[model samples]
Target: MADLVSELRQRASALGFDAFGIAAAEARPDLSEKLQAALAAGWHGDMDWMAETADRRASPVALWPEARSVIMIGVNYGPDSDPMAALARRSSGNISVYARNRDYHDIIKGRLKELAGLLSRRTGEAVKVFVDTAPVMEKPLAQAAGLGWQGKHTVLVSRQFGSWLFLGAIFTSAQLPASEPMAESCGSCRRCLDVCPTDAFPAPFQLDARRCLAYLNIEHKGPIPAEFRKAMGNRIYGCDDCLAVCPWNKFASETREAKLFAREDLREPPLSVLLALDDAGFRALFSGSPIKRIGHGRFLRNVLIAAGNSGDRALLEAVEARLEDEDALVRGAAVWAFAQLADGERVRRSAEAHAAGERDAEVRAEWAAVLPEVV
Candidate 1:
């Protein structure tokens, strides 16, 4: 069995996984208390679903009691070049590293299943695989599996892989031996906290999702909050400010996962081009990626916020097109974008057009305020 475990690790490495570990499947006894503490403090914000599945998220054993082992693997996804420099060009939208090319879920999940099948064929055991979903605490499980210690950013970080790895796990009924845990190497570095544009982290190992640009752009369903809109700059989809600033990333290597590498079109894509996408256009552009899950309304809302922040006159036409969008959320965001770039006269006209017929009270109020002399 030990030799089998060793052989599996070799296969995973050949399959492009940077690190692999096996964890005995048992409920993480300490996790429930930590989850209760986080939920009690409201660190999860409006992510009410996290609270809904409280028991399962706290431990894998509670999710599937029959599971006896979890095989966790990490795939390095770092690009060869710097991902942060794209931010300096104000006219372009900064997509996060994870979403740069093909979605991680598809890439990692496919490989995890192949490994699961190999294990099942050898041991005649039932297995299920997951990446980024299911009721799994992948980071904590990865830590327990000895893949690596969870870093200050609360992500599983391996010294061999730095912080640029995508994770996946296969749960099996076979009684596999577990691996040893890795010690933390974060030491005294506070660079991740210092780099946050919205001050999203209250402390090391804690994240306030409300203030996280990733959450704001992707998870939160409503308007981009007035306070954070300006700070968002041109980050249309998600923010990588904290991840990009980690000193440990100096050891990061370019990924060999061709599917996970950044597409030239996604790197610093024009804000105008993204803003021009309506529902059909959005569906066409993000067909196979996680971005498709965000839907056009929420995505366009983020783009409009970026368009407002771009401070570039070139995107005014795209902003103008969204002014008449049927969705009040998009129209409200468009009104804000126009206010950022257009003169007072243009703001007045756009605001008035939406003010009378807009059924959404919040959007109407936003339009009223955007009007030049309405104050």
Candidate 2:
């Protein structure tokens, strides 16, 4: 069993995974309770899938009863430069480091399937592989498999890889030796908590997804709350403030995967350029990227919010162009962005011109909400 585990690690390394570990296919004793507590507290926000898949996510054995050993792997995606620097470029959209290139789901899933095939061939056992698309409780499983500990920010933090790892797992019937779990090493560190722009963390290791910029910009489906727009700064797709502040990142190495390198165009795309994208243009720009999953409407809504926070008067024309956009969500965000960029009288005049023609109640309300109170 020990020899098999050693060979598995070597194969994973050869396949380009930065870290690897193995664990028994049993439930972690505390996972079900922690998941229940998080869902009960409403910290998951509109992510109803967490509630729906709670039972399956609680245990690997529950997910695949015949599985006897689980293989957890990590692929490092550390950025070459500080991701926070893009936030300061107000006129540009700040895409998260992970999403600034090819979609990790595709990249990691393909590699995981390859690894699973290797395992099956060697052990003559059936195997299954999963990336982020499944409800596998990957963070905890990674920790249990000795990959890393879940940090105070609710993300896995590796002593070698920091918070930049993209995790995947393989479940098999082979009874491989389990690696020892890693102990939490984050002693007396509050940097991740203090660094959150939206105060997403309610306590150490507890996150309120509703208040997280990454959740709001990515998973959220409706108009962004007015309160969060300003705090969002220039972050359009996902935010990286919490992860960037971690001390363990000092030991992190930049991703060796060429496909995962940040695209120059996506690294700091001008708000003006992003706002000009029609559905076809949006699709063309993010063809194989993860940002494409949100579709053009949600992507535009995020861009408009960033435009509103940009405080760049130059974006007023771009904001105004979306006032009558086909999507109500985009129109609403445009209205809010226009109000921020234009003066009170100009906003009022534009509102009067568009309010009568506006069919969406929410978009009309945005016009009313941003206008100065009548004397």
In terms of lDDT, the best-performing candidate is 2
Q: Tens digit of lDDT per residue, candidate 1, span 1-375?
A: 998898899888777788899888873578889888888888888989889988988877788887899999988887666777878888888888888778889878878888889899989999989897877888888888887777777776777666777889999999999988677878998787888889888889888888888998899989988889998888888887777777777766545552256888887888878887778989988878779998999998988988888889988988988888998889889888988999888877766666777788768767776763553
| Residue-level lDDT tens digits of model 2 in 107-175 | 888888988998888889999999987789999989999999999999999999899999999999988
TM-scores for candidates 1 onward, in order? 0.95, 0.97
How many residue pairs in model 2 have overlapping backbones? 0
Worst 10 residues of 2 by lDDT: 252-261
> Which parts of model 1 have CA positions greater than 4 angstroms off?
254-259, 372-375
- lDDT scores in order: 0.83, 0.90
Clashing pairs in 2: none
Deviation of model 1 at 308, angstroms: 0.7
